[model samples]
Target: MSYALTLEEMTPALRVLRLIAAECAHLPAPFVHLTPIEPERLELSLHDVDLTGDTFNVFELWREALGIDPDQVTFRVQGNGRTRVLRATGPYGGADVTLTAYADAPAAVTTTTGGAA
Candidate 1:
């Protein structure tokens, strides 16, 4: 999957991730961790997740934190099956990141008969 986001979009995306990280930091053990490997990219890993909040909440929180128009930033998700593409848009910059749910192919199925027919 591929995406095209502007610099403006990237600002809020990063902000939201940071906010989430901060909130989780207070927890005894957080489910997700965000590590910035590059200036424009972050790595998010989840150990446990709470589904109490929806994606919109994240977007709103990001908007409030970044002091930007909620509509200015947009996030999109797309993929074929296991892999997904997430794109964020903002004023300063935008970024696209791909997430693979299953990095390896599924194991093949086999049929058994009386012996090995």
Candidate 2:
């Protein structure tokens, strides 16, 4: 019997993403949103996450793990009652990353043609 086999080498950023996912086993959501920002960037938006509490601040923890400095982080809170909190964006290995967590539901920052969102 012949079995199919698939393989692809993991990039440094991807490897780190895997590690982060593994560490998030204790978190609420798993793999909520992932947007490819053309060319070489990725935006990971998570909703209903603990935005203020330091007990489970996944974003900051991820920043530390990704070797991103605190000052380099851009803290943004847009939208109304359901704030769109985005603060972790930096160069990690081979990807430009923005891994944010929202206290409520979050909409995708942009769309294919650009901004219908």
Candidate 3:
């Protein structure tokens, strides 16, 4: 089996969303939503986060590791910092996924970020 969407087909923002969601799937509660809030803005919501854990902020790490610009994205962490939902606008389009399904059969997309590949 293969992913319906390929790495070459995803935009930079979409790839970031998928990467973060996959990265945080190991948390007590994993990411479950990736929705578009506007024409160019997208949001990713997680079910839980480890506040006391050193991995609370996956944004900076993923952002830096992926080289995503701050101007293109924003984040809203709720539930006493135990839950986080990242928002990005610019390149992500119509990228929404179920954490369980995705984690089970994740799309084979390259981690490379920025520009055309």
- The most accurate candidate by lDDT is 2
Q: Is candidate 2 or candidate 3 better by TM-score?
A: 2
lDDT of 2 by residue, 34-105 (tens): 323232455566554554543226666666766767887665556664464646677765766666765543
- Which runs in model 2 stand beyond 4 Å of their true positions? 1-39, 50-56, 104-117
Best-to-worst lDDT order: 2, 3, 1
**CA lDDT scores, all candidates in order:** 0.38, 0.55, 0.42
Candidate 1 achieves a global lDDT of 0.38
After superposition, candidate 1 runs with Cα above 4 Å error: 1-50, 81-117
lDDT of 1 by residue, 1-117 (tens): 334555555564476556645754543222222233333543332221225423344434443433455455444333444222222334322433221111222344777879656
Tens digits of per-residue lDDT, candidate 3, 1-117, equal 444554355454466566655765553444433333321233443322445443335444434443456675654555555444554433322443322101112234658888888
Every model's TM-score: 0.29, 0.50, 0.30
User: Between prediction 1 and prediction 2, which has the larger TM-score?
Assistant: 2
TM-score, predicted candidate 3 vs. hidden true structure: 0.30
Error of 3 at 111 (Å): 48
The number of the candidate with the highest TM-score is: 2
Worst 10 residues of 2 by lDDT: 1-10
